[model samples]
Target: MKHFFKIVYCIAILCIADTSYAQRKTAVKAKTTTVNAGLKLPTGFHASIIARDLGVARHMAVNSKGDIYVKMDRVKNSGGIIELSNPADNGIARKKTVFGEYGGTGIAIKNGYLYASSNSNIYRYKLNADEQVEDTGKAELIVSGLLDRGQHNSKSIALDNDGNIYVNIGAYSNSCQEHDRENGSKGMDPCPILDSAGGIWQFKADKQNQTYGDGVRYATGTRNVVGLDWNNEINSLFVMQHGRDQIGTMFPQFYEAKYADEIPAEEMFLVKKGMNFGWPYCYYDPMQNKKLLAPEYGGDGKQVGRCAEMEKPVVAFPAHMAPDGLLFYTGNMFPEKYKNGAFIAFHGSWNRNVTGQEGYFVAFVPFKDGKPSGKWEVFANGFAGVSKIESTGDAKYRPCGLAQAPDGSLYVSDDNKGNIWRITYKGK
Candidate 1:
């Protein structure tokens, strides 16, 4: 009889423990969402608006002081780099200051200096301790007269540890050719267009008087690299390449509607000095795990070798994830496993007839000793409106920029809704 009573008590205790565990939300579930914005979150991560009611914020950078520098591509009259700061870690942004009336598409901070780039030019702003733009008032125009015909004109900036500034001068055309957007077209032989753009350029970051033409070509054949960062571990530059689009309409035989929607992988590549990833001529297919020849350059779905001249990607994701920002987590605020992982902001896909629009969230790519371990998982979601993956007609905001606070928390920006949300890990 006594033995039977002990068994009952043990069973009751076990059930109670299980119930308690199931009732709690993980640290990832603390994500806060914006009002009127089509968004949702998974079970663990939490999100909250860092700064509300802003312009079409594209790219952003945060310094050690936790001040945010945002670049908005809005009406020229009301555009430029702005500084945002809060009094405390969890405090709302209490200050906003705008400097340099000129507008740009990119912003970054390196070695105590703030750099902002226009679609066709680059500029720098002086900053003060409070993280304010020095009201020094005037921004020095570093480079001007770049090829900015609207398409792929934004120049995201990254600085290598060796005092070199790497600017992404995206190709104006989707696929480089003599005539623009023509079907059955082939890439330019010798690809002379690479000399001016469609690649990254290394410039003397300390040189105060350098111009556009003064920089050297760092890497080429990158169609459009809006997201770039220096992998301090690898001691090399890494960039996420935005693959070309309209594969089926441009070349029907190789690219079916199904293939077009999910074939060419948006690639993350380590840029070795002078290495070329054959853009306009080839694309890396994540499904097949191979570098396949592009439809425009002519080849079957499984074709290869024509793009052999190009470099390979370190990691290949779905066709249109549209990675716009890349950051390696160097802070210790998160779990130990995430120490060296990479976080990417996928802006979401717009062109695919894909009934279910994908992306519009932040993802973490786990790394082991500087190399991606396995599959990348969604770190923080809810930007897209649908609760279930199959549900459509809900997505409203598209994620665009990513910034890390001094505490290792992440800030995601969206141009679709013009709001920024700060994400922090509260997991045990």
Candidate 2:
């Protein structure tokens, strides 16, 4: 009887252990499924959170080996860049390593090098054959002394195939006003701010310590450009300009407060050398489909004036959406329609006080032969996790950066919560 009792007890213990293991496995699976269903994607597409709480996660880059390097908006723990490795092939970053002393917006992986930028400087690190940064402590400064006023100082960067790197030096003033953002203040003629800011500067990729004098002003009149990418298909640079704010408050006599919520379309420019997109002097109005003279420059919102000579945007988005990241899709994991298309991460709006906040999603622009072939559509949303955003603080997550993995999957980084979401498409 005692032996039989012992046998029953041992079996009971084994069953309990087995049940616990099964429960744990089920819980993990459920969590994964829940996260995958978090974002609202189109048919056959899914998303899963790979990394979380990464400290102001901004722009990101993926190497050939699928290693992800994400730049932080601010430095933390003596490092700014986070390197994630997924060895389990489960689409989650199981191992994370943080390196780099300084922090800023732009980060890209190029030919055997990882390039990153601070607000005032750009740096690069050598990569090994495994496509990992060879020395995290040893970084080579490529570009330095770029403009960094307290406002609009994100030095977003992109690299072209010809060994040239482009950096956006955003204009500090809202519209180059004599007293910035003040009502009734006239815009400065010729915009002295344009001399040192409000444009894209091109510098040599391999040249170290190159300053503004060593770089060329590739294009001008851009208010601020946080989102930019090198389009290999067109062999040119493309950028999304964050249009100036306070259209109504600054010029209430010309623009109604309601109009401020709609006019001054965020512009997508196919940038070329010496091309100007008319910043403080003019702003594009999508409803009118024309570049209208800015009220700060003495026009009542309908005059084209000197704006006729300024280059127009290839595509214009809604105002105050804050386009932060741009990635031209060249991967094959998605449908053929997505090939060579552009994905833009709108970081959401804050000052749209009249109409509540908008944006906080990734938008897709279909491209054919290097131009937008069709209308832009919402690619991924629900980052805000709410039906409407009353204020920027009400949002749960803000999509800030975008990157494509080697396997053709898309990764988006959230600045609010520091969550990195990996988006993949399954066949329909």
Candidate 3:
């Protein structure tokens, strides 16, 4: 009987050890699953769901207090700017507030003021000591009566340390065609659209009720710029120009479908005063690495023509990436290699039919002394969460905007589902 009891006791010990080991394995699996739950980031980087259901969240800005203010492409409950705050560092916003009555794609905080823009106007609200907007109803109109002729009028903004605000006025027509993208139609020479559109304008950040006439035309000949930033190191503006479209549709004899899909590269320009980027008359061709005369302007796809004299891009990217946000890293929390580099949010392409869809990711361009030093890299990807995205509708999340927090984390906003992801680096 004693020997029988001893055998039973040994069996019980074995059973308990096996169960404990199983439990530990289950815990480790749960942790692995949780860590990989968000968007796929660079190794050693983690992305967490910070805010969701923000109603078409666009560009955003982080305040000194670590609060986030995001602009909305669609008005939610009659509000536009969404403020998210989490003082506990819990990786999620414990409080959410909505303010402002306009919906648009520009938001930034500068020098005790919060700035935002609609399609045709720019406004500013005073910030209190807590780095929050004092009153949404007291928004001061900085500029009004901007040209908003329906297409590409996002009016994205960037601020300089010198009290100037830069706002983009995108071209209404794709290439200033005589009949608007019709085959066999010639381009309107001297492109009348450049008068009120196709460039960035400088306005006073503190001025009120200013019109287009009050602002100075800072840069010209950019097709349509949604992503722009002020590089303090260079003390100049940098803009991502969305390349023109429909080369095959408008001039099938000159361009094949594949060439049209990938010919003109999306350009990043170091925009300075009186700089012309050769819009309507020329475009940057990545294959040849030269400015080619646009098909609408009396040349084949390979002709440089007068385009040889236009200002060239600092660097060119693949065609139709639709960069909507550009940010220069100046935070100490990131690696030293990332300091002063540029992060661009490619909002994804809509018309790259031949090559499928591309550019639903954030890219990093290493900059040294305010110039691009190395090739661009894909920093944050997997936002679409699909093997292939043939159409824009097939994308689950389209990255539209990027913001860097005070603590050096990055914030990405999705317009498709209005989700905000905060990415932080915590590796050796």
RMSD of 3: 7.9
Q: lDDT of each model, Cα atoms only?
A: 0.76, 0.91, 0.88
Q: List TM-score per model, in order.
A: 0.85, 0.91, 0.91
Instruction: Report model 3's TM-score to 2 decimal places.
Output: 0.91
How displaced is residue 381 in candidate 1, in Å? 1.2
Worst 10 residues of 3 by lDDT: 29-38
- How far is 195's C-alpha from truth in model 2 (Å)? 0.9
> Candidate 3's C-alpha lDDT?
0.88
Give the C-alpha miss distance for residue 396 in model 3, angstroms.
0.5
Worst 10 residues of 2 by lDDT: 28-37
- Looking at model 1, residue 371 earns an lDDT score of 90
Model 2 C-alpha lDDT per residue in residues 1-428, reported as the tens digit of each score: 99999999999999999999999989856644674546889988988898888879999999998988999988888789989895229757854678888879999988899999999999999999999998899999999999888799999999999999999999999999999998788899989999999999999999898999999999999999999999999899999999999887777778778887887899999999999999989999898999999998987989999999999999999999999999999999999999999999999998786988889999999999999999999999888877889978888899999999888999999999899999999877
**Candidate 3 on 1-428: residue-level lDDT in tens?**
99999999999999999999999999856653466444677788877777777778899999988998989986787788888894327878754678889889989999999999999999999999999899878899999999988899899999999899999999998999988777778899999999999999999999999998899999889889989999999898999999998876778798889888886899999988889999989999898899999988887988999999999999899999899889999987788889999999999988887888889999999999999999999998877867698888888888888888888888889988888888888884
Residue pairs in collision within model 2: none
Each model's Cα RMSD = 10.5, 8.4, 7.9
Residue-level lDDT for 313 in candidate 3: 92
Off by over 4 Å in 3: 1-36
